[model samples]
Target chain A: DVKVTQSSRYLVKRTGEKVFLECVQDMDHENMFWYRQDPGLGLRLIYFSYDVKMKEKGDIPEGYSVSREKKERFSLILESASTNQTSMYLCASGQFKEQYFGPGTRLTVT
Target chain B: AQSVAQPEDQVNVAEGNPLTVKCTYSVSGNPYLFWYVQYPNRGLQFLLKYITGDNLVKGSYGFEAEFNKSQTSFHLKKPSALVSDSALYFCAVSPASGGSYIPTFGRGTSLIVHP
Candidate 1:
C-alpha cells in the first residue's frame, strides 16, 4: 500500500505568521500536489511539483510557495498567514492514474 | 480546459436501497474519469476510475460506476446503502491523452444513508 504522510494533522497560527505544511510519500511518485479544500469550492490546486526543484502554479497560487528539495518530501509555505488562509490542506502524490492522499492538515489562522 | 460536474449537492437513501450519484464531465479529448469519497474531517479516498476498455468499472467498498460516452456521464451506483456509506463524494476528470494527468474535481455530493 502507498502511504502519504503529512507533518501535522492540525495547526493554528496568528495573522502575519509564517506557516509550513509538509508531506512525504513512500511510493517515490514523480508528481506531488498541494490543494486547499473549501465548502462549495471543492479541491483547488495550489501548487504541484513534477520533479525535484521543479514547481508549477495551479489555479490558485497566491500567497503560497512550494519546495521539493527531495523526491520523497514536498513542503507548502505560506509567506504570511492570514485569516483567509485558514482551511483544510491536502497533499497528494502519484504518477498518473491514481493519487494517494495524506490525512490532511486543518490550519486555523487568527 | 477540462472540468467535472456533480449535479446533485446531496443524495439520501435508506439502508438496503440502491443509490446513484450523478457526474458529468467536459474535456478536450477522451476523458479519464474517477470517483472519490471523503469522510468527515478526512482526506479524499479513491473509490474507482474509468480509464478504458469497459464502461462498467467496480471499485472498493462495493461501489461501481458506469461510463456513458454519449451522455458524458459517469454515475456512481451501489446495490444497497449502509449507514457507514455516508460521505462526501467527488467526481473528477482528466484527458485520456495529450494533456497533463492533473485531474479537475467537482464540488462534491454529500451522501446520507439512513437506517
Candidate 2:
C-alpha cells in the first residue's frame, strides 16, 4: 500500500506569516502534486514536481511555491499567508493515472 | 484539454435502494475515467476506473460504474445502498493517447444515504 503522510492535520496562521505544509510518500513515486480544495471549486492544482528541485506551476500557483529537495518529501510554501489561502491542502504522489494522497491539512489564515 | 463534470451537488437515497452518481467528461482523445470516494476528513480513495475492455467495471464495496463513450458519461451505480456508502464522490478524466498524465477532477457530489 502507498502511504502519503502530511505534516499537519490542521494549521492556523496569521496574515503575513510564512507557512509550510510538508508531505512524504513511502512509495518512491516520481511525481508529486499540491492542490487546494474549496467548497465548489473541487481540487485545483497549485504545483507539481517531477523530480528533486524540478517544478511546474499548475492552475493556481500564484500565492504558492514548492520545494522537492528530497525524493520522498515535497513541501508547499506560502510566501506570506493570507485569508484567501485558507482551505484544505492535499498532497499526492504517484505515477500516471492513479495518485495516492495524504490526509490533507486544513489551513485557517487569520 | 480534459475535464470532468459531476452536475449534482448532492444526492440522497434510502438504504437498500438503488443509487446513481452521475459523471461526464470531455477530452481531446479517448479518456481514462476514474471514480473516487472521500469520507469526511479523509483523503480521496480510489473506487474504480475505466481503463478499457469493459464498459461496466466493478469496484470496492460493491460499487460499479458504466462508461458510455457516445454520451461521454460514466455514471456510478449500486443496486443496494448502505449508510456507510454516504460520502463525497468525485469523477476524474485524463487523456489516454499521450496528451497528459495529470487528470481533471469534478467538483464532487455528496451522497447521503438514509438508514
Candidate 3:
C-alpha cells in the first residue's frame, strides 16, 4: 500500500510568520502536489513538482513556494504567512493515472 | 483549459437507498476523470478513476463511476448507500495528453445519508 504522511495534523501560527508543511511519499512517485482546501473552493492546487528541483505554479500559488530536493520528500513553504493563508493543506503524489493524498494539515493563522 | 463541475452542492439520501453524485468535465482532448471522498478533517480518499477501457469503473467501499464521453460526465454512484458514506465528494479532470497532469477539481458536493 502507498503511504503519504504529512508533518503536522494541525498547526496554528501568527500573522506574518513563516510556515512549512512537509510531505513524504513512500511509493517513489514522480509527481507531488500541494493544494489548499476551502469550504466552497474544494481543493485548489498551490504548487507541484514533477522532478527534483523542478517546480511549477498551480492555479493558486501566490504566497507559497515548494521545494523538492529529493524524490521522496516535498515541502510547502509560506514565506510570510497571513490570516488568509489559513486552510487545510493537502499533499499528494502519483504517477500518471491517479494521486495518493496525505492526511492533510489544518492550518490556522491568527 | 480543463475544468470539472459538480452541479449539486449537497445530496441527501436515506440509508440503504441508491445514491448518485453528478460530475461533468470539460477539456480539449480526452479526459481522465476521477472521484474522491473526504471525511471530516481528513484528506481526500480516491474512490475511483476513469482512464480508459470500461466506461463503468468500480472502486473502494462499493463505489463506482460511469464515464460518459458523449455527455462529458463521470458521476459517482453506489448501489446502496450507508450512513458512513456521508462525506464531501469531489470530481476531478485532467487532459489525457498533456505535459502537466495537474487535475482541476470541482467545488465538491456534500453527501448526507439519513437514517
Better of 1 and 2 by lDDT: 1
TM-score of chain B of 3: 0.98
| Winner of 1 and 2 under DockQ | 2
Assess each prediction's global lDDT (C-alpha) against the native. 0.95, 0.94, 0.94
Using Cα atoms, each model's DockQ against the true complex is 0.82, 0.83, 0.83
lDDT of 2 at B35: 92
Q: State model 3's lDDT.
A: 0.94
Off by over 4 Å in 2: none
Tens digits of per-residue lDDT, candidate 2, A1-110, equal 89999999999999999999999999989999999999999999999999999999999999899999999999999999999999999999988678888999999999
TM-score of each: 0.99, 0.98, 0.98
Candidate 1 chain B least-lDDT 10 residues: B92-101
Better of 1 and 2 by TM-score: 1
Inter-residue clash pairs, candidate 1: none
Candidate 1 residue lDDT tens string, A36-60: 9999999999999999999999999
The deviation in Å at residue A1 for candidate 3 is: 0.7
lDDT of 3 by residue, A1-110 (tens): 99999999999999999999999999999999999999998899999999999999988998999999999999999999999999999999999869999999999999
Q: Residue A101 in model 2: shift from native, Å?
A: 0.9
- Please give the lDDT score at residue A31 for candidate 3: 94
